[model samples]
Target chain A: MAKEKKVHDRVNWHKEFRLAPGYIILSLWVLFTFVLLGWVVGASFSTSKEIFSGAVFKFETGIHLENYAKAWNTSNVSVFFMNSLVYASISCVLLIVICAPAAYVLSRFTFLGNKLIQNGFVAAMGVPATMIVLPLFGLVAGWNILNVSLANRAVLIFLYVGINVPYTTIFLLTFFSNLSRSFEEAAAIDGCPPMKTFWKIMLPMAQPGIITVTIFNFINVWNEYFMSLIFANSDKVKSVAIGLYGMINSMRYTGDYAGMFAAVVIVFLPTFILYVFLSEKIIAGVTGGGVKG
Target chain B: MFDGAALLHLIGIGKGVTRLKKNKTMIVVFVTPAVVMFSIIFLYPIIRTVLMSFFKIEGVTDAMSKWEFSGLANYIKLFSTELFRISMWNIFRIWFFGGIIVMGLALLFAAILTSGIRFKNAFRAIIYMPNVVSAVALATMWLQYVFSPKFGLFKSIGKALHWEWLEKFQWLDPSHLFIALLVAYCFGMVGYHMLIFASGIERIGTEYYEAATLDGANRIQQFRYITLPLLKGVTKTNITMWSISSAGFFLWSQLFSMVVSNTQTITPVVYMYQNIFGAGNSMTERNAGIGAAVGVLLSICVVLIFIVCDKIFKDNDIEF
Candidate 1:
């Protein structure tokens, strides 16, 4: 009876020790992220008075909808939001379309100078985008584009595509190479042309890749600042990222915390919502990009 | 129900009706938009920048009119300038120490979590959460969270600990500014690199560890023997990218540099901006030559750094 009781107590102890030190670290990471996000959302809702007063959980009186309205008008958030959407959408579409064929050719073809082209792109990736930004500014000024007044949205799109090409090509090359070649071959054997085979067979096979590159490019373009500041000086072309800088810089002394937080929420909400719902797709994209090849 | 013979006949007919056209024109048509955009948007600007860097401009305003062909002068000036020296040193400091610290912490976090810990996915998603938020939003949040002398959490904690540094020094001031910025940069980037490392760790086979455990090896021994060696390729990739990114880390510094107006802690890009778009900072106005000269210098530094890193790592076949 004594031996059996000792064994039972040991089993209980082992059960209690299931969560290891690794689990503690993981828990802390999760807690930190949640707390940071909670702080952002809480600060958004809380009035300046409540924020300073230490009434952390009084959601009823602290909540304010007017702050968003004030920011929307005063910060020109609506205009910037629309501009960002336009720029991001156009840039993403252009990036994928431009990069997809380049990636395909690089991955599939064994033409002369293929190594040279690949090296060029890899070298470009190593070069800082900021390094080139100054020269481009001069070029833009010299060309007298947009009548030398403001940087054009179209030009920004052009710049965005350039910055994105290297990354996109590499990303898609991995996806294309990993995908099976039999379907395209079979399609060609069945009297479909090479182009038709690529579109009907190979393109469909690369859907996950297409989605991943598009999402990443979209986010990158959306969050871009330095390039936007250089190439998008006008009100109509200012993306939300650039606009946020303008607002914060202007209001730094005025202490418009609520308004600024409102702008932050507006900027953060769409992507956050998408990530929350389509997390599986995002995870699949990231892992597939990294691991499959 | 229809007869089996009729169904078979109809399936063959359906296949015949949807036969594809064998046209080579379609390939060109499909490929044209992409090629044009790539050539114009990407290829053109790069070529233009490289070519323009070689030329000399005489007048500030008339960039087109006052250009002379001057070879390598811009590059020569780049090497001579004190500003360039400081910027290069700053870039090295950030890349060497800051990159190592951030990437190291990320790798450690990734390794610990890869033991099939509970809430693994939740932890990963949370860590990556920062990447979703705009950098502007992040900087704003961090500015308040760490820098506000009165209510900033760092200040309060320092005070509670009776730290002289808190009382005597300003974190965002020139003396300690880079340290503060380095901390913020690490916080912002750790999640990204962590995800990369975690995904890499997941790719490592569990059987290696299982065999090690059976052979009288402890957890530490198993990791040291198996995990570190396997993680070499990923480590290289992370290091290369972070190094390149650090070398280019001027944009945000430029934006927030104005926080301390009239200070020259501004990166190369900001310095260029101040020169070109002074906006009444001085009646002695913009110069394209200075801007192009800076660009040429920056590019040289980037290429040199890449070559040096490749030499140091000496492993070109990094899979990740």
Candidate 2:
């Protein structure tokens, strides 16, 4: 019995030792992330000279709160911020409005060309944005629609909605199909129209899936850069991502590294705050799509 | 009585026909917007891109009528170019080597988090936060804050450790630039893949682990005999995802390079962009055909990998 106990102790020790590396790596990564972000936050509040001198952590020079003000007002981060907010929110809502109905019909109803549409979406997921971007740009330019700022914004939103339809529809398809048909049957028995049934009972049943996909769309649209860079090139309509890129490029001439960091923080804040609050939803949205696919 | 009943049945059949017509109309109403938008924006562009790859267009903005039919010339030009070859090699390294590092770390972290570790949620959240931030911001933070030779984190650490050479490491230099970008990109990506792996690991029933423990298996043994085997599907998913994302690597390479055509950090997408936009000196004559060809080649690469993964991971017997 004593020998068995000694062997058990040895096994426990071995297990702990085996897990030590995992713990170490995790802790190191956590520490590095915090330190890096903390440093950025700190530098954003410091003077450029102080930041360059590596005195960011030292509070000898009081925090320069004007970096954010300069970044927001003079550098036009506010415009970009509002632009991003508008684009992200509108695109997300429209994506759901357009995609949910399609997904619902595709999953719940047996219609002509249903399999073909399903296969189309699945095939679209494999095509990269680069493949479509050149032609799309040419088409828009050829149409001369981008000259109007509103039209440009509309095109961007439309592209966002269109590009995301496959993923959103595919993500919600499984959710709609998995729901029991009894509710719909009852609704039909109660003399409810098919449209009304979808709007009232079925949509409510798929609320969780809708919310998850919306969160995913929000994050994706919020961070979208390449398309925005191509389509929304004007100062009046730049998203936060492109605005930040512009700020970084201009910083070379201006040499306001602190202001640049401030702009970076301003751009990163919303997504960071979103992650803090709705991480579970975000994780569910991302991993849900991945695992299902 | 039989004639009256037959008339009533005929009326009932007519009503059913009207209802079916309404249902079909509703389906069209429901699906029309997505289908129309998808065809115009997604499908049309893909078809146009494939068609454009066969023509010699001076610029992306050029009129479609101006395209000169040049079959397979763009592909030959792409293959003949040294920089294009280098870009291809860079992406391959990123897809395979970067993939190995990322998947390994993600699996390890996933296993640890699911092992009843403390602060699992907090650790997961912190690691994944980088992904929430835009790649532009993250790359800037890395280029300026962490990799700067003067006031960088590396410099500070190097000074603290009394290592003079380490403090002056030129991470952004051409010699080391690719590796630097790879490391930074991997840092931001680990959490995303880790979360995917964690979800996969969490789906496994505790009974497997309990049974293995009952048989006196160690943690490593349980991982080897059960977790790894069950994670084949997840691994295949991660590889395919990594391939797709790597093929589309643009922003990081753009951010890392000082010039538009910097060979060290160029990827296929960046090459395509340069050609389409007529950005670089060597690429002054804009050729949408070459750009489209680059895109077609990259798509083929992704599709081929996906097919290979599908074949290799065809086993569905381990349903759990």
Candidate 3:
């Protein structure tokens, strides 16, 4: 009986030893990640004097809420926010409308050069935006495509659609392929035409995939700085991501670290909130979508 | 396009409905938007970019007087340029070395999170927080507090530790620019990629690890035998993204660091940008030909990488 008890104790000790290192490493990683973010938040709140003086951080007598106001007006972020919404939202809508049908056709049909076309799209999806951004810039500028009023915005929408089409289409194609076609056939049997069936039946059923694609596309368009910086040179069309650059760069001369942080928080707030609320859905959609695709 | 054998080949064969007669109108309607967008945005511009490479701007004024065909001159110039070569290396370093760092860290984090840790939600949220933050904002935040040389947190920490090398080195220097970009890029990446990996690790059943553990396998041994093999699909996903993404590194690198004068960090795109829309230093007429050439080269590189990745990964039928 004593020997059996001793063996049981040994097993317990062994389990504890095995689990200890993983727990320690994980705890340290989690702590460091939080601290880094906390440090950013802390620096934003700290006064310039507090930042430069090298003394222990002390809270200001009054919170620097004015910094946010300054960032809003000074950096022209209000315009940026509006423009970003218009650009990202419009692009997301366009990608779904266009890519959904494209994906559906690709999923359902087998035609001449279909595999090649699909492979082409997959290969294109992997193409980096950097590879083509400049050439696209040249093509647009040389043709003077943005010379017309609101043409730049249209061009941007087009570019966004093209950039996102490959990935989202591939993603959605996978989803559509897995979907049972019985519903579509039943709709057809009920006298619904193919286009109508696609619009009403397949699309509604594909809501989860659509939402996932929209979220990815929205984030990509919203936070994209490179293409926006090149194309949307006017303040009227700047995105929050690009607009934030002006505030931070201004710090080189103005040295207002507090305001820069305020700008970061403001720019970060919307997407951050969205993530906090919908992260589970987004993560599930992506993981699930990836597997099916 | 029809074959009885191929139809039977795919899973759920009998469930698939008979194909309707090829409706040209339906095909056109369904395919137009995708086709139009692809042609204008991708194919045309690619061809245009290639054509741009063969011509040189000939003018005393800012406006182009004529396009003088300078066959392969720009390509010759690009090859001869030290900065272009270095920038190519920088691209390779980021995508290659950076790929290993990112994938490794992602796997480690995914493993820990799925290993029955406490506070999974909070830990996942905090780690993935960087994904929600704009790259521009994240870069500014890092520069302001983290990488700031004078009185920056990292600088101060280095000073306190008497790390003399850091005290003397400014990280923004040209030689260190790649490193700086890597650090900035890695933070933004941790969230999304790790989320994908974590979900993947979760999807993998615990039975494999339990079975291994019962066989006297240590934690590391179990991870090696069970986790790594199961995570092959996730790892391949990472590879697909990383390899092709190198073709687009110019966008991130340019935004992260302001280009240094007298030296060009000329990725093909940056070079094209300089040619098409002149920046502060290089205000010249639009060189559409050269831009086209660079675009074609970039398009070719993109295709090449896809082929190379496929060859390397082979046919791992593991999805996701």
Candidate 4:
């Protein structure tokens, strides 16, 4: 027994040693992340000369508030920011409105094509945007709708709603299923109609799930780049992602690195704030569907 | 002519049929919008893309009447193109090599955070911070601030460590560009996967660890015996998610490259983008059909990986 204990102790020591490197790596990564973000924040307030001089943190010549203004106004980040806000908010709302009823029905009622719709959503979730985007581009462009500003935004929103339905529905399906049936039964016993039960009782009952998925959808739409890049490339309706990308591209000639970083910070600020305030929701929304399954 | 009992049964059956019809209408009312949107946007586009790959489409704006049936020529052309071959190789490397690194590190960090670590939430938040930022922003920061030769983080660290080779390294150079992009991408991805792993680890009850400890099992032994087996489902999910994300990799590549068709950073999606939009300088003519072919190929790769993962990591009878 004593010998066995000694062997176990030795095994324990080996395990500790193995984990020591992990702790070190984690610490280094944490340090690297902070330093990099801190540097970016610092650089945003400094002049290009100061940034190039590598004294970004010093702030010797005072902070450049003008960089933010310049990035917002001259660089057209404000336009992009507004576009992103509009797209993200409207799409998120529309996503919930459209997907909630479908998810609720799929979860609650067993009807014809119920299993088929569920399976389709699961399969659709696996299909990447690249698989459909090329043909979608062709379909949209073939309509000659790209040149019209309103049509451009409408098409983009339509694509967003279409693409996100699968995910939002799947995410909500679990939530709706987990909800107890008693409330709906009670409402039905009280002579509440099925539609009314869903609208008034169940929708509000699934508020937490709805809010979580909405937050996720909002973040996704806000950060979306590729589709927006393909469809809404015009200056009138470009998203923050493309706007910052265009700014970065032109900065090569403009040489306004400080203002460019300012644009980066501005574009990053909304989602960063969202993450800071509702991080728990964000994390839950991201991992809930995958982990639960 | 019927008996009284048979007439009563017929009346009951009619009522049941009407109820089912009512239920059907309700279901249709609830499900129609999602179904219609999905069919139009997702199903139609996917089938059209698969069909489009078999045709010769000159431009995205070209009508169906203009599409010439090219059969397997698009696929044949894609396989023959050197750039397409390079892009496939790059995506494969990203999927496999990056998969190992990201999953390994994420699982490790997740384990550490869940193992009675101090400030677990704070650490998890910090790790996940990069994911919240836009990819374009993150990539730009990496290019200008982290990988830049003049005042990059690497340069400062190299100077401090007195590492001459590191100081002289050109991260954006053609030879080093892929590695640079992969590293930056892995950095952003680690946090997202870490959260997934952390959630998985958190789902396991603490009683198991207590029971293992009482049996004199060491931490590593407990992790191996208790954690790994239980996390089979989560690992499968992570692998699938990683493959899907890696397959859609485009923004980072385009951001990292100086030009649209930088061979070093060209990915399958970027190649598809080039073919569809005719944005890159390398393409003589826009072939939307080839782009669709690349899309079809990438989707196949993802589906195959998902299948293989499912087969390998069969969720056996591990009760929660």
Model 2's CAPRI class is: acceptable
TM-score, candidate number 4: 0.92
Q: Per-residue CA lDDT of candidate 3, range B1-320, in tens? A: 78543434453244344444534556668877887777777666555455556777532122334667799987787677665566666666777778778877777777777776667777777777777667777776666666666666567667878998876667666776667768767766766677777876777777877888789998778878876777666666766666655666655565555634323234555665565555526643455555555556666765676567667656454557
Ranking of all predicted structures according to TM-score, beginning with the best and ending with the worst: 2, 4, 3, 1
Report lDDT (Cα) of residue A49, candidate 3: 70
Ten contiguous residues with the weakest lDDT in model 3 chain B: B57-66
Candidate 1 chain A TM is: 0.87
Q: After superposition, which runs of candidate 2 have C-alpha atoms over 4 Å from their true positions? A: A1-19, B1-22, B62-64, B163-165, B259-261, B317-320
- For model 1, give the RMSD to the true fold: 6.1
* Distance from true location, Cα of A19 in model 1, Å: 6.0
**Model 4 chain A lDDT-worst window of ten:** A284-293
Name the fnat for model 1.
Answer: 0.34
Q: Rank by DockQ, descending?
A: 2, 3, 4, 1
| Residue A274, model 3: Cα distance from true site in angstroms | 1.3
10 residues in a row with least lDDT, candidate 2 chain A:
A284-293
What are the per-residue Cα lDDT tens digits for candidate 4 across A111-181? Answer: 77889999898888888788888778877887887899989999989888888999899888999988866
Candidate 1 lDDT over residue span B204-302, tens digit each: 778988888889998689778887777766776677667667756765576556567534345666665665555646325344566666665667766
Instruction: List the lowest-lDDT window of 10 residues for candidate 4 chain B.
Output: B8-17
Which tens-of-lDDT digit does each residue in A100-163 have in candidate 1? 8767656665545556666666666676664466546656656667543334877887888878
**Candidate 2 per-residue C-alpha lDDT over B247-304 given as tens digits, one digit per residue, 9 for 90 to 100:** 8898998888852336889898888877666347677566789999998999999999
Residue A176 C-alpha lDDT in model 3: 93
Docking class of 3: acceptable
